[model samples]
Every structure is written in structure tokens, then in C-alpha cells.
Target: MKVLITGATGTIGSAILRHCLQEPSITSIVALSRRALPQDISSPKLSTILVSDFANYDAALLSKIASADAAIWAMGTTDANHEVNVIYPHTFFTTFLDARKNSEHRSKRFRYIRINGAFTVSDQDRSLWFFSEPRKLHGMSEARTLELGKQYRDVCQTFVVKPGGVATSGAGVMECAGKLFGDGAVIGAETLGAFVADLVVHGEEEEGAIFNKRMVEKGSALLKGNK
Candidate 1:
């Protein structure tokens, strides 16, 4: 299957890309990023596209997107730039859905796995005390994407994954320890990547959003099943 990945150079995204590369079922990958990947990765199945603007997609980019069977949206920022975190993804779903309508793919459901942070309220309209606006924006983003998925249910299947503190090999010793002992609130980057990749390649049959602990459990099961 052909898979398109955004933010392919970020910690979680790079891990997902790695797993996808190792997966025999995935034949092609399109990596879209604002800048080129940090390291040169030589793989016949992998291709990179440098994008200057997330909101705008040129004809060439559109054509590439149309060819993909699934997409993983792992791009995000902590600066509270709602435009980047929220608006861009919503636009991508709309554009991809439009493109899918024109394409002649055999599968009716186009898989879209959106990587979201934990504690993001799906019901954005509800009030909250701490970090209210940012949480609401994040929730709104998920809600909007799910809305689009519902509107195009015949052609689109969206999955929102909410992972807590992500620990990576590159993290400092203290940070890694904190994440490891975070008690179900944290997950390793590799683990998250493998889980998301499995969902993209094998497809997650369960509908709606998935939380961190569930992700870990399901991902572990998938790994064992493969072995």
C-alpha cells in the first residue's frame, strides 16, 4: 500500500517512517515536510516532498496525495499556533477527500491517522479551567476532522490517536526516566510509531478516538500477532 506521511522528520513521525519502511506490506511512502529530512535515508520505497506552506498544495502535490491509500498526520507544534496544528490538518482532509473522489482506488475507505496529544477534549464547546483555549483548539481540530470523515464516510475513515508523554532514545536520561515512570501517561516514541504504522498498514477496525493506554495495549498485541 502507498502511504503519505506529514512531518516525517519529527520524533514520532520519523519513528513511524522507520516502521513503515520495514513493513513488507507498504510498497511506497511519500514524506512531506517544510524542510528536508535531517538524515539522508536511502530507500527505494521512500520519497520526500519539500513543502513551504501546509495550507497550500500545488498540482504536483495534489497528484501525489491522490495516489496514496492512507495518510498519517504527525505534524504539530507546541507554540500554540492553532493555524498550524488545527487549520492545516482540516484543510488537508478536505483536499485529500476531494482528490480521492476523482481517483479510481479500489478501497472505498481511505485511512487517515491523526496523531493528537492526550487530554485533548473532543467536545470543544465545553469549558475547562487549565490551558482552556489551547485544549479547546485541539479538540476543535479533532472534531472538525471527524466531521469531515462522517461527511465522507463512504470514502474516508479517520482515526485520532492521543498519546501522552512520548519518550524517545534521543531524550536525556532524566527525561526518559520520568516518562518511563509516568504510570500509563507516557509511551516510547518507537512504541507509538509502531502502533500508528500498524494501524496505517493493517487498518484499525474500531471506530472513534483512541487514548494512550489503549494505544499501547493494542500496539503490543499487534506486535505479538506479527511475531
Candidate 2:
């Protein structure tokens, strides 16, 4: 299957890209990033596109993206850029959805997997003054994206993955301790990537949202062929 990945240069995104490259079922990859991917990673199935503007899409980019069967959205930020967290995703989704409507692909549903934080609030009206506004904006972004998914449920299938603090490599002692003591302490980037790739390639049809611990459990089960 052809898959389009955004934010391919980020931590989890890069890991996901690597995992997708290794998956035999994935025939092609369109990685969209602000900069070109590293020179070390090379594959005949992989193509990288430099995207300077997320809010606006040219015909060339839209046509390229329209060919994909699925899209993995991992682009995010901890900063106060509401545009990046909220507007950009909404724009990207609408653009892709429109393109899909015009395409003649055989598949009825276009899968969209979004990477979100564990703390994101689905209810936009819920009050939480303790958290920063920027963080709340992330929640808003999630809510807006889900809304679009519902609006176009007939054509677009959206899945939101909420992972806790992601470790790029081996977890430290404190991180391990947190994992043992806490509910959603942290998860390895490689593990997250593998889990997401599996979902894209082999995930069963069911719910649309997945949390951190459940992500690990389900992903592990899929890897073990128990799912």
C-alpha cells in the first residue's frame, strides 16, 4: 500500500519512517517534511517531499498526496504556535479529503492516523485552567480533527494515537521506574513506530482512538501474532 507520512523528520516520525521502510506490505512511502530526509536512509519505496507551507497546498503536492491509501500525521509542536497545532492539520485534512473525493481509487476508505499527546482533552469546552493555553490548543486540534473525521466518515477513517512521553532510545532508570509505577510513563520511539506501522498494515477494523498502555498492549499482541 502507498502511505504518506508528515513530519517525517521528527522523533516519532523518523522512527515510523524507518519502520514503514522495513514493512513488506508497504510498497511506497511519501514523506513530507520541511527539509529533505537524511542521506543515510535510502530505499526504492521511499520518496521525500519538502513542504514549506502546511496551510497551503499546490496542485503538484496535492496530486502526489492524493495517490496514497493512508496518511500518518506525526507533525506537532510543544511551542505556542496554534497554527501548527490546529490550523495546519485542519487545512491538510480538508485538502487531502477533497483530493480523495476527486481521485478514482478503488479503496472506499482512506486511513488517517494522527499522533497526539496522552493528555489531550477531547471535550473542547471542558475547563482546565492549570494547563497552559498552548497545551489546550493541542487538545483543540485533536477535537477539530476528530470532528472532520466524523464529518467525512464515509470516505475517511481517522485513528488518534495518544502516547505518553516518548523515549528516543533505551529508557533510563527513572523512566523505567516511572513505567513500573505510573500508568503511562513513557514509550520507546521504536516501539511506537512499530506499533503504528503495524496498525497501518495489519490493524483490525474497530475503534478510532487508542491510548498509551493500550497502544503497547495491542502493538505487542500484533507483533506476537495473537491479535
Candidate 3:
């Protein structure tokens, strides 16, 4: 199997790449990022493509994707300030769906996994008002989740991982504070990576499904037991 990973340098994304590289079934990998890949996990089967533009993707990228069987998209910005939170998540989901639609390897059914928030649901309205608006923006997240779920319904096998809070060895002090104080729990990136590898190799059906952190942890255990 060949895989394409976007935002391959992120905490969770990097973990997935590391685990996939060690999988004998994964013959090749293409990483898309704004900068060159870090040398920490270099391998012959892995290649990196630098891309800064997300809205207008270059057709040349299809060559790399042509050899891939799946894509793990981990590109999302955390800037909830301004209109970033509203825009970035929706854009990220659409880009992956659009890219799959235009790929030359359409013959190969592509499996796409995206990192989403745990609270995002498929149903509910979000038209609230006042200073409490930002707190209620979860409806925006949920709507985006449902939008992506619908867009990729039959086009690709989609998996939405709703992680609570990702824990990485390199996490900064601010992240640590949130992990300790926020309404979140720590989930190791390695565990998340392992699940990604299993999903790629096993070809599990997660289309329109939302797997929260606890669900993911339990699912991983169940998969391991079945294996």
C-alpha cells in the first residue's frame, strides 16, 4: 500500500508517518507540506512535496497521489481568533475531497482520515448570539464535520478522529497547561499513529463515523484483539 500524508510534520501526523514507515505492507509514501520533511524518520520509500497553496492545488501533485492508496490529512489551524477556526477546518476538509476527485488514481479507492474535535456532531443548530457566541461555536465545528462527511460519502472511505487533546514529547509549556487545566485528557500520539496504520492496512469502514478519543482507544484495543 502507498499512502499520502498532509501536514506530516505535526504531532499526530508525524506519529502516523512513523508507524506507517515500519509497516511492510506500505510500499511507498508521499508527504505534502509547506517545508521539507524532518530527517528524524527518513526512509527510502518516503518522498516529500512542498506546497504552500491549499485552495489552488497544482496538477503536478497527482503523480505522487497516483501511487497512493490512501491519504491521512492532519492540516488544521488552531487560531480561533478572527475567522480562522470557521474557515480553516472547512477548507481542509474540502481540499482533500476535491483532490481525491481530481486524482488520476481514482481507480484506487482512497481512504481519508481527518482529525476533528470530539464535540462536533452531525445534527444541531448554532445560531446563538452575544458574548457567549464563541463558546457556542461548537455548532460550527459540528456542521463542518457533517459537511465533510456528506461530501466524501461515496467518493472515499473517510475516517474522522475526534481526539480530546494530543500529547507529544515536544509539546510546549502552553500546551501542557491546557492538558492540565482544560476540559481534555491526554492521548499519546504513538497510540493514535498505531491506529492509523491499522486503518490503512485493514481498510476499515469509518465513512461518516466520528470516533472520539475514548472510542478510538477502545476501538484500537478491539482491533488488536481481533487481529
Candidate 4:
């Protein structure tokens, strides 16, 4: 199976790419990026497409993306790069729709897993609302993601991954502190990456499914059985 991965250079996106490379069943991988990919990660099964603007892609590129069996949309702006809460979703949705429109595989289900934090729609719980304060921009950014999820719930499947604090490879002091406190909620980058790959390659019946870190890992394993 061929898969397209956007934002293939980012931490989480790269992790997913690495995991996909190790999967023998995956035939080829197309990575869409603005710049050249790292040389160290090159492989025979991989191809890279340099894209200037993901929000708008030319016809040629669009057609290519449209034909792919599936795409993992991972492009996003961090707080340091862009005013995430206000602008990230606009760019994200525009790119997502463009990808869908360009996809050649008509029935090909696009599995979009948005990385967001824990949030509830209910306002009755004021305590939870505070949790969204410090991360207001991030929270608002995810709201737009949810909007996209609802919009494409019928045409395509969208799942939001709400990880509290991501724990990377080296257990830094911050990560250790988090682990010590009740706020130690975190998912390793590699773990999250493998989880998404398992979902895409082996799980199609999981369409329109929303999953957490734990659920992603579990659902991926379970879906393989039925498939």
C-alpha cells in the first residue's frame, strides 16, 4: 500500500515516516515538504515532493495526491512559528480540502489525525475551562480542527489525538518533572508515530473514529485482526 505523509520533517511526522519505512506491507511513501528532506533518512521506497504552499497546490501535484491510496495530514505551525490559535487552522483546513479535492483515489478514505490537547465541549465544568486557559491559542486552534472533523465526518474520517504533554526520546528534566506530578500525561514521539502508522496501513474499518494515544495503539492492533 502506498501512503502520502505531509509535514514529513516534523518530529511526530518523521516518527510516523520511520515506522512506515519498517513496515514491509507498505509499498511506497510520498513525502510532501517545503524543503529537501534529511539525507540520513533516505530510502528506496520513499519519494519527496517539494511544495511551496500547502494551502494551495497546482494541478499536477493535486492529481498526484488525489491518486494516492491514503494520506496522513501532519502539517501544522507551532506556537513559536505562527500565531497558532488564530492562523494555523485556516492554513490547515485549506490544505486538507485541497488534498481531498486532488486525491485521485475516489473511495480512498483519508485518515486525518489532528494533534490536540484534552478539551470538552461542555461548559458546565469550569475547572476544565481553566486547563484551556494557558493553552488558549492551542485550544482555539484545535476548535478549528474539530470544525474540519465535523465537516468531513461524512466524506472522510478525521480523528483528533489529544496528548497532554509529549515525552520525547531523552527524558529531559521537564519530562521527569511532569512524570512526577499528576500532569505527567505524555506520549513518546516514536510511540505516537507507530500508533498512527498501524492505524493507516491495517485499519480501514476504523473510519470516522476518534482516538486517544491509548486508543490509537489499541485500535490499530485490533483493526488488523478483522481486516
Candidate 5:
């Protein structure tokens, strides 16, 4: 399966990229970035596309990525603002669907995986103490994607993965703090990467929102299944 992935150069995105490279089931990978991927990474199965703007996609860009069976929006950062969190993904959601409009004959079910945080509150009226703005923005972003997924159920499916305490290699302090606070469970980058990769290659029957608890449970299971 060919997979289109954004933010393939970031931390979580790198983790996801590493696992996608290792998965034999995935035939090819298309990485979207503002710059080229690091020199350390290279593979015949991988191709990188330099994109200047995330909010807008030219016909050439859309056409290039339209063939992908799945897309993983692994973009966004800790201090991600409204444009990065909402506008980018929203634009992408609509643009990708437009990209595939011409290819209806060759269309297969497109699985779109969105990486979201666990504490995100979809309820706009609900109160949050910490990271309220970011959480709400992300929540709002996912809400819109879910709506599109429902609307295009025939041709596409969207799944939001709410992973908690993404413990990356050597990030002791951050990992520890993450685990101790919000989510007690710490999921390593490798495991989380493998988890999402499995979903795109094997495909999931259902889609919506997946919390940290389910992520840990299913991610672990998916990793083992890979072995």
C-alpha cells in the first residue's frame, strides 16, 4: 500500500516514518515537507515532496498525492496555533478529497489517520485548566475531520489517534513527566509508530476517535502482530 504522510521530519512523524519504512506490507511512502528529509534516511520505497504551503495545494501536488491509499497527518507541534492546528488540516481534508475527485474509477477506501492529544475537549463549552486553547483547537480540528469522514464514508475513513505520554528514545525528563501527569501510560515512539502504520497497511473496519487507553491496548497488540 502507498501511504502519504505529512510532518515526516518531526519527532512523532519520524517515529512513524521509521516504522513505515520497516513494514513490508507498505509498498511505498510519500513524505510531504517544507524541506528535504535528513540525509540519514533514504529508501527506494520512499519519496519526499517539498511543499511551500500546507494551507494550499496546487493541482500538481494534489494529483501526486491523490493516488495514496491512506494519509497520515502527523504534522503540528506542542505550541501549535490555530492555523497549524486547524487551518492546515482543514484545508488538507478538503483538498485531498478534491484531489481524488477525478480518480473515482480507481478509488479505493482511503484511510486517513490524524494524530491528536488525549486531553482534547470536543465540547466547546467544557472547561479545561491546562493547555485549554491547544486542546480545544485540536479537538475542533478532529471534530471537523470526523464530520468529513462521515460525509465521505463511501470513499474515505478518518481515524484520530489520541496517544498519551509519547515516550521517545532518550527523552527521560519529558517521558517521565508525561507519564507521571496526564496519562499514566507511556507509549514509546517505536510502538506508537508501529501502531499507526499497521492501521494504514492492514486497514481498520471502523473509524472515529481512539483514546490513549485504546491506543496502548491496540498499539501493543498491533506491534506483536507485526512480529
Candidate 6:
């Protein structure tokens, strides 16, 4: 499978990048980011591209990225800033959807997986104790993206992964706490990466929202299977 990944330099994104490279079924990958990836990470199946702006995609660039079989978007803001949270990702989603309309690859399904938070609330009018505004704004992004996917369900499938707390590799303490109090609210970064990579390879029929508990279950199963 050929895949494209954005925000490949981030915490979760980087892990996804590494895992994707390790997937034998993934024959090709494109890493689209604002900056270059780490020098230590290199693979025959991986390619990197730097973008000056997320919202500004020229025809050539859009055409290049639109050819991929799937895209993993990890570019979101902590503050839920309007541009990064909504506009940037939405633009890319629409761009890919539109580009596929006139391309021959329309015969294939395009998978799009976006990283969201476990606390995100899609109901605009819902109440919250803290970070209400930011969650709502992020929710707006999620709702918009999902709506678009619904509209173009014939040719594309979209998924949102909402992880409560992402722990790095060998997060012993975090794992213990999550087992005791998380109720599947937390997951390891490597585990999340494995799940995301599996989605790209075997998620031809999966869609809609994915929660932390589900991801943990799926990811753990995938890691064990690969071993």
C-alpha cells in the first residue's frame, strides 16, 4: 500500500511514521510536513516533502499527494486554533476528495485517518468544566471532516482517532496508571502507530470515529499478530 502522512515530526505522528516504514505491506510512503523529519529515520519505502503552508496547496502539489491510497493527518493545534484545527485539515481533505474526482484512481478507496482528542465534544452547545471552548472548536473540525466523508463515501472513508493520553514507548508508569484508572483512556505511542499502520493496510472497509479503548484493543492485537 502507498500512504501519505502529515505532521510526521510530532509525537504521535513520528511513531506512526516509523511503524508504517516497518510494515511490509506498505510499499511506499510520503511524509508531508512543515519541516524535515529526523535524520535517523530513513527507509527505501519512505519519501519526505516540506510544505510552507497547509492551506495553500498548488495544483501540482495536490495532484502529487492525491495519488496516495491513504492519508494520516496528525496536524492539529493544542489551543484549537481555528486555522490549524479546522481550515488546514479540512482544506486537505477537500483537496484530496476533489482531486480524486477527475483522476483514474477513483476506482480505488481513499482512507483518511485524523488524530483527535478523547475529550472532544461534537455537540456545540454541550457544557464542560474546563477547555470547553477549545474542545468545541476541535469538535467543529471533526464534524466538518466527517460530514465531507459522508458526502463522498463512494470514493473515500474517513476516521477520527480520539486518544485520551498518549504514552511514549516503554511508558511503564503510564501503563500501570491507565490499567488502574484509565479504563482504556491511555495507550502507548508505538501501539497507536501500529494501529494506524494497520488501518492503512487492512482498513479498506473501516470508517467513522475510533476511540482510545478501541484503538488499544486493535493495536495490541495487531502488534501480537505481526510478531
| Leading candidate by TM-score | 6
lDDT of 4: 0.62
TM-score between candidate 1 and the true structure: 0.87
Which residue ranges in model 2 land beyond 4 Å of their true spot?
122-131, 172-178, 221-227
* Model 6 C-alpha lDDT per residue in residues 1-227, reported as the tens digit of each score: 88999888899998999999998888999998888888988998989888898888888887787678999998777786999999999988888778887887888889889998888888999888999988999888888888988998888888988877899856546656777886456888977898888887877355888888777777877777853
Question: Per-residue alpha-carbon lDDT of model 2 for 1-227, expressed as tens digits?
Answer: 99999888899898888989989999999988889888877799999888899999998888777878888999988765888888787898888888779877735688888898887665656777756565677777887788888998888888888888888766445346546967476777776887899888765477477777876666556556676
In model 2, the worst 10-residue window by lDDT is 169-178
Kindly report the root-mean-square deviation of model 4 from the true structure over all alpha carbons. Answer: 5.0
- TM of each candidate vs. truth: 0.87, 0.89, 0.72, 0.71, 0.89, 0.93
Q: Residue pairs in steric clash, candidate 5?
A: none
The candidate that achieves the highest lDDT relative to the unseen native structure: 6
Give per-residue CA lDDT, model 1, range 86-106, as digits (tens). Answer: 888988888777876877763
Q: Which 10 consecutive residues of model 3 have the lowest summed lDDT? A: 127-136
lDDT of 5 by residue, 34-70 (tens): 9999988889999999989999999888877878888
Which ten residues in a row are the worst by lDDT in model 4? 117-126
Give every collision pair in model 4.
66-102, 66-103, 66-104, 67-104
Model 4 spans > 4 angstroms off: 80-104, 118-134, 170-184, 204-227
Q: Which stretches of candidate 6 lie over 4 Å from their true place?
A: 204-206
* 3 against 5, candidate with superior TM-score: 5
List clashing residue pairs in candidate 1.
none
lDDT against true structure, model 3: 0.64
Positional deviation of residue 154's Cα in model 4 after best superposition, in angstroms: 3.1
Point out the worst 10-residue segment of candidate 5 by lDDT. Answer: 170-179
Candidate 6 clashes: the total is 0
